[model samples]
Target chain A: MPAERRARPADAAKVQRWLDVVAALLRRSPDRLTFVELAEQVPAYGRGLRSRGDERWQESAVARMWERDKDELRALGVPIGVYPDAGGNRSRYGLETHEFYLPFVHSLDGTPARRTGGPPGVSMVAFSPEELAMIRRAAGRAAQLGDPAVADAARRAMASVAHDLAAFDPDADHGETVVGQPLDPTVLRTVGDALVKGRRIRCRYRSMHRDVTASRTLEPLGLVFQLGHWYVVARDPGDERLKTFRASRMSAVESLAPNGAVAPPRGFALAAHAASREAWELGDGEAVTVRLSVAVHIALGDLPGAAPASAAVGPRARTRAATMQVRRLEPFLRWLLAFGGEVRPTAPRHVVQAFRDLAARTAATYGAGS
Target chain B: MSAVARFARLLRLLPKVADGTPRRIGDVAKALRVPAALVREDLQSLAERVEDTSGGFIEGVQVLLDRDHVTVRSRWFRRPLGLSADERAAVALGLAMLAQEGPAESVPAIQRAREKLGRLGPGDAAVRAGRIGPAAPRTAVAGAQRETRYLAALQQAWVARREVELAYRKPGARAAEPRVVRPWRLVSARGAWFLIAEDAARRAARVFRLDRIDGVRLRSATYEVPAGFAVEDVLRDGRVFMGAGAGTLEVRYGPAIARWIAEREPHERQPDGSIVVQYPLADDAWAVRHVLRYGPDAEVLAPARIRELVLAVLRRMV
Candidate 1:
């Protein structure tokens, strides 16, 4: 077995400094401390100042270090507040006591005596046992999503919950099991991180219809896991149009920024884009409404964006008539063809002709001419 | 892990062990979902003293680490940290997915949990951005709802160790058949649910697709799962279908859909730009439907019986 890579001494000391800084801030909560005061509280910030030849560089480095520490803590949901002084140079930072800590979670059935003023820096939230169990099951299910980004986030969320609960046994079984879909963990993680951080990504995407791989830059807005696949709903900066790219088809996904340098367009609703769309409606072609004779048992509403059409009599009397808008004809044809004789496209002359041609071509492939 | 990540973990870890109670390192590691050695390293770092501005050492937290167990005495960070934005979003998405795919009865509880987590409320940016919540709209797909209903009932039966008689309609069958089985486990694979159970009549384990089950009637008789039986034992090949005599199926995809097919599962690329895959074939009717779904994009390459079945379906369709 390969040896474990231990943490360097310098890294350990840096972590210790961070711990000390957080301790100082929490100890003096609700009281703002300037950078000078914080430096006093965390001695490591001023250490080796005299030994360095570049005093000015060392001072700026210390300032940058302080800024980094604050950003890191805020990222961990520490709720560190900053108040700039009148001079606009000296900023006082402090921890928001109420927001820093998790609320006291209790079972709804328990009716403990309420203190007129509970302990300082503490609040409460109540949930039933079944509710808590559901949350636990949800976390477990999320961990099995086959997406590393989601799994890590789920683990962190559950850890926080476990910390607040007394006598929390992590080994307790939740009676839920999942066989997650096989997905590219790297692509999922990269795309997910970019979406969460609101960053742009450059990737090589293999387009299925065109059967060509092309490099493109995208501003990732949201992630959707549907139909046993993960998709990134993003916008091409060049066109400023929303497109959904299957996560598995993306390769070499590289984030363009260190932080969230870009934000989604104003008033853009991701739900509208993330809604379960049929294969045919996902294309960029001109809209074509194709009338179909669908089996009565198949609900039109369930077909996603389908509307009832005027029924025809005679041979098609038993089947209901429906019309659905199609952006890509091939996928629409394939979808209708999949239902075999149960569904038939009877619409504008071209659509019916195209359907026949496809069927004939398919039959020809099996040595049966149309 | 990077030092910053380690720092964040240490912040969370301090609250876990700072209650002045002795906790086994292994137990703490398991609870934190981290390696035991990493836990030990964090504890060691916490035990070290830091120099204050006045040339004096300040002991933030006192740690008592021994061979197997460790305890900490600290007045700092005794409370757990609140969930970060990303973490909250993740939890919200989990609840949302469960709301969509879990048992129907759990919806209310799932909703309550979401409300408590400050999600799903009006004007929530995360919800607006579609970062967290159900990916699909809540339009009830009859087939999906039916599967969830059967899944809920089967789950209860499995937990109670009760035998269930399923009105299961096999593929291509016109009528449902009654099958008595002892429920063992409910597993989801490839976006579908299946029941890994023991067939009482055959006295052997079988896998049943939840959608194909017309109805589930709980039987009064209870049965114990065999000691040596494991879900993996039946699903060793990673294929959910467990027909009596399964064979390997070879199919080739046309160039047009080859890239799409390659994205889904493993396949070998042919020089002609097509792709060939060996799939597990258990039911002839399933193979026919699978090929029919792809239309002419897919062709049965080997296994003449399966090829014949595909041709037969194509002939009927044409």
Candidate 2:
């Protein structure tokens, strides 16, 4: 076993300072920074605490600190380059300006930093205030629900737009608020990068259903947020078979290919994959419509797959029967169970049986007596 | 962050360029939380890496410094990374569910995402996207035009952690009943939105259907919820009716109903394939009304008060 890291408050604050120092250095351009020059300008880099002649002490302490900071920054994706100093040794460090930025596109809107390019019609049209807000919100929502890095990326994408982070409608997610489970931002960003680049990713994935973790190379396809969880559908590069993996369950994520590693089929749409699904499918099962005895005005209006087929007036408004088309019986049953006594299945005996069994088991949890 | 993580972030910020327009070095520095010098080095290293390494992925990728702005000259440098159509769709779908009850201000964002997905990639054909579930927020859809005010008012109170005066129509009630509640959490189930709150008058936790909530007004009074106030306790069996019976409530279902009920629900199954369900009834009256949906297939057998209530209701039906 390895030793546990002794976490300290300064550890985090130090990272921010390290980032700031790097930013300041990049502005200097092809100018190489020696230890003395760096420490003088960026106090965060920590200089030789003593005098200039103390080479041994400075090399052991300050140089070591600088070395570790460079590796840490690199681990975080900072590209620090080393050029030869006056002594012709690779001692000075600097950044190459172009590699760190996106392909610069000057937008008519005048947001100089905004990155934009796609098919012609895509970029030619200008977005209305509302449209931009929606796109930004969608990106914002992804950050809110997925990971911190995801949020940071979204913030960067919308750098041109001036929107407050504490905007309304974000806090109150009027729909399915499954705020219980949290996702690892690192995992989200890794797969996100893979998907964008059309690259394969080697993932240390923990399959909750199978209760196993294994390393597998996957061709990143697309991500879908469903039923309070985010799921990524990836094709097994080896088999060409696609599988949906829960985002939260991914233990480790690493991109295995570069952008454009795999050019997806000429025209592949993720919505098509998502659109054909029955809300109740639950991965396995044949689609079947079941007749349900649901109350009138129950408002089964727009649940995923259980749409209202027909309605029957009952003795009481509460007992009105409604037939619902259930593509996936399991999710449909779970959905019905929420209604409890207000809904029951009368026909398509199997669906009815499933609904009753679920209800009975739920009722039995309280124990027999009352 | 590990190297893989950092590299992934770097990729998102690096878009492929066709034109020679310069991007702000500060933008990359600020976005990645690294210094501009570090970004410059990273870019230089990356460009050199492709030039040095054999068979690099991107073609003719070169980073150039132009005054304060930096741009890449690459044959294939596109947006460093783009969210696939599916990702955008997933986000759009989730937002659509919330849109029902979400503020009108968020609609544009929802619509914008939808349009973006449409143009994301060419689908083989226009395939209908599959949905895992839908959030049919009651007030958002039932009377969408009229309920915006109610939705915003209730959401305001919920966010502020204040008391709310809601005119809620109890099940089967003709008109809404006025009550003050300490809002806790909002829940969605079976295409409907519900608020699990502490009903001041009842002095207990209760789940009120959002649609039945006629009008809601935020109160200035703020209240602290008791410790460990998870909704699972009240949502047990997913029943919203408040409990009234003290002892257990047993319901015996006929074979047809038993077989269906016992399939997954935990219950005491009989030798004849019949099943018995025992539940801690929230309200005896509400329970009676609930069991009535099973019609003649189910009967409440225990807790004399509940049995009496069921019998009285049955007699009235006849």
Candidate 3:
């Protein structure tokens, strides 16, 4: 051996690379092949050690290398066993399929990915083909979301995961029902990175309320996608309240202090923040109750805060009355107006008057004097 | 890759050789594309770890070396492969959303996938994954169930590479007529779904809206889509009916509605906060209906013919 057995496989990165090499050699062999035979069959191994003179090409070096390879692969969960000389043959070491494979029987949860801790990471669990295809769909969605880097990462992850299941029997059929709105891919990826890393971001955002387009630094808490749009729920440092910003309206997204020890305030729930209110309702203001009579043919189920008349209506009725709250008056008015004459504000004389004034102008635009 | 990640990969590699037949370290390494030296070390290390944790080889796993083949013997190794909880949840959410989202014909497949994933049995933590958000609301689906049959039929034709007989109705047409088509791809844009296929009668390509496809039936014959055909190229080639043409129409939006248009629609904004939404109109009547959508918030300043058409619709309505 050129060197002592002091080298450690603690750095799994390097070990990971070596593990790939060893697994490759073992997988191609149908029967047990000795370390001596391995050194001869593997061109790279012999060439690498011989070329670098890193280790003397001898029995001691060979034995030491064998020991280390076993340690790293074993660390990975491969159960490699030694077949003792049964009929006066040299002891051979290899992985026997019956002993190494962990076939899915029942339990979904078991060993942790790592014996140590960080954030929650992957620990293998039984996944059907349907589960895999579902993951593939998400990866596809993430790619379409406008960022190249994320797209590449998603593509790679999908490929690697799909590769893991290549040896398994077909589990299920993957369908084509997938559909999702395209988003600014860059923003989705950037915000997702920030949310996971507890990073702050600086963005030049165009506020929906005003003409102001300025750069603001915020601590992003989470991301929410609604109605084909992506929004980042974030908070200004030192501020207790979180604000939402449409990702598309922001530009020059840059992360700040990725390594800084930061996290959302204790118990900050991303799901709650995302689903608490519709994006339009994120505007700051006092809520107002308003009633609207929409043409009977128009469905108000998707409208915010809309509830229909509980009882049956007369046959002659042309409209159905529903009530909802309004906070962002501009957006609310725009939405109501978009329905044209099919919608009418029936309560609050001031709001009604406002709607009437807009209606008159619209009527005039069509040369139908009001 | 951390030691943990390596461990995870190691676990996955187990099933590759858990059959109890001793495999050569060299052969296993070659198949898995690893160095034999490393494979040898991995087995030895794992054997000890499993032993220490679960009372040495006899309890759960066995690792040994005989005549250079590293063999393992464990009945439990035949277990199904593993995925993380977050990963499972993400997959579940994707399946749920795809099922609810349009491409409605695909719902059955998505449902099957969901069912299979759900079949991991009771006490399965994946089943406990909270409700998944839809990719897009069901409004598009509810807007027209009449179009679903077309979607399903065409989808079948597309998957099987077969020709289809389509009863397509034009945007303003009152009736649908049968037209044979070689279905190619189904593409989505700006909240609308369009089927791109070769029109056998015209011997050219056409883009038909899902709603406009009043009826479809899979034909007996199959089709071979031209190799390397790109849907984007075809759709961009004079297929986008409402975009880019010889001239741009000039119209202004009121301050109240202009911001909304500027925010959601493509247009140019004026210094005074008004927005001009430009459209390349093929005809004045089309322009009139499009602008009338904004009601009084928008006006056609030029093309007197277009203004007259708008007045006709409004005056008639009043």
Candidate 4:
């Protein structure tokens, strides 16, 4: 399968549960399924199975209901194939691609930067009139350059600041303690240059976890603002590896000239390497092939080459009769690992063995191994 | 294929009068890289496309040639094809947006350019309509709210000139931390709001995330906003938190990897278009990991340090 599959996740529990039922249906029915029939069999979290006679359902409702059904199927690692029927009959819907594809949707599992709460030891400070004017101008300029409606909204909010400046009494005991002071201008400018020029920057960094100090050269690439603090997307030249560093963690910065090399692309774009984690990165390196037997729990019966979408799989049916070829192994492994033993890693013995060994090792460590 | 194509061919060739100018049929043909016979056959057809109206349109279409050179001189008039209404609205909106970003002084130049386009009516009506500026909607009410926030912080900072306490959260970090910092100038980097301040405890400049700031309060102390505090310096300080880290990496290439790299331009291109290129990286692990993704197609070449790291990682995985 394409590595792009890893980009979409059963990122949320709602979707993850949906995938489980879909996978079960695919395992049982490998052929094409009518939308209604598939949705009937797919389980719902809080509701008991509905009778096929339930007249409350509409085609649009069926369509909407399948989103969760499909999401859950993907989470369980079942591929649901869809195709246009060649017979031209109105009732026939064929399965097209052999493998299942989950549409590209933004996962709800936001990164750590998105979590709420201010930086430690700090209290909220409202913007002043002059500062609001600057913010409005700044946000407007930013929107004009690239960002869309959100930037415009920011500008609108900035412009709303009332001019009557009220003095904030520091000792008035607002019942909140300030965490850190405003950053000096000199440092922000220096860091901005390093990022723009993609040059090596030398800086005095203080580790947050421990009392340690060190000077290091960083190849700056990108910057991200999340959860109310500045963070640099830099690679440590010493290690030549990428890592996110907090702005507050640094003690000082020493600027350096560009090394004449063009900087790598970064920012918020999906294509940017920063957006993907290391596991996804691994699958991109080399493509590996794996073979798997469809479990009875999957609804592969609806697949064109397979059986019907509603084929029943009784527990005693027993034989491991189906198999498939998968190209990328890392993401598959990660996804399969999350399934525990429900979906077995069948082949490329190395991969299967690796999974087995890992499980064994963990079990032994926990004194639960046979 | 047609008289039109032949005429276009001749007009395009007029620029290459490389040596001394030649005005004869042969010179024009030679300049155009075409046979003289072909040039002669197309001259009439080409003349028709070069309009000089009032009947003078066709008259000016005639080309004058002398032993020294060939010159195209004419008082030609052609009907204008204007822009549609939607296009005009789009242009007006775009211009208004552009005006917002640039210095106020540039607005006049924009107006003048619009006037010139209008006078040159040879273009579409939409193009002409674009000359008139689109009025921007008012946002004074919301602007007041934003001002209240900015001023409140500014006044607090001004009073303390000493470090104002800030709460900041760096993205991707497991959690946010507390830091004491002296407030400096607040600016926007790209689109995000940022506060440039000095770390009072560390005695170094740093940037704070305005949104992540849960709290802010001024202390009873005073310190200058530091005359030498350059915005760029603080940005660099903030950058360290951005890049993964810098390290050297060695990539080895097999024939397939070499060909793939060559075709895709995956790495930076050298003037020679060689298969391999190297540089200092902020995120060495990321680079090495990325290179490894190419699988058997590429290899990691020395400095042996990176190779050892990759090997060590793979060994642990295996």
TM-score of each: 0.82, 0.46, 0.56, 0.25
Question: Which candidate number maximizes DockQ?
Answer: 1
Interface RMSD of each: 6.5, 13.2, 11.4, 28.9
Residue-level lDDT tens digits of model 3 in B1-318 = 255444554554554566677888788776556666656656655554311122111223456776588777654433423333223334444444355444665666676655544332222322232111111111011122223345545655775788988888664454688989997776644445578788999987776777667668788998888877665564332233433454656789978667756765567788887888766555554466456656677898767766765565454334
Sort the candidates on DockQ, descending order. Answer: 1, 3, 2, 4
Local lDDT at A88 for model 3: 62
What TM-score applies to chain A of candidate 3?
A: 0.57
* CA lDDT scores, all candidates in order: 0.70, 0.53, 0.55, 0.40
Give the Cα RMSD of candidate 1.
5.6
Ranking by TM-score: 1, 3, 2, 4
* CAPRI grade of model 4: incorrect
Q: Which candidate leads in TM-score?
A: 1
Per-residue alpha-carbon lDDT of candidate 4 for residues A110-129, written as tens digits (9 for 90 to 100): 31121111112111223333
Model 3, C-alpha of A171: deviation from truth (Å): 17
Model 2 per-residue lDDT tens digits across residues B1-318: 233333444454454233466778778677546677656654544443311222222233456765467787543334433332333344454345446446667666566556653443223221221111111101001212222335545655765678999987776665678899987766543234567788998898887767677778788899877779766665554444445555678888777667556633469988876789987765555576556556556667787777665554433222
For A1-370, candidate 2 gives per-residue lDDT tens digits of 1123222335423533454345555546557777666665444443343344334544556677777777665434345666677779977777544433322323234443343442222232244444544554455545455455444544544442221121322222322233424567777677766665567888787664455689887776776555445677777765655677777667678887464465444455554554435456545456566666656645454333345555445455654445555556655665554453456677887766666565554344323321
Docking band of candidate 2: incorrect
> What tens-digit string does per-residue lDDT give for candidate 3 at A1-370?
1133222445433443344334543453336755555544433344444444534544455456556666555433344455445686655655543233222222223422221111122133354443444456655544443445444544433433443354422222222222343445667667666664567888898876786799999888766544345567788887978787877788888878765744677887665566535433655688787888876655564365687744666777778888888877655664566554466678877877777666556558756677
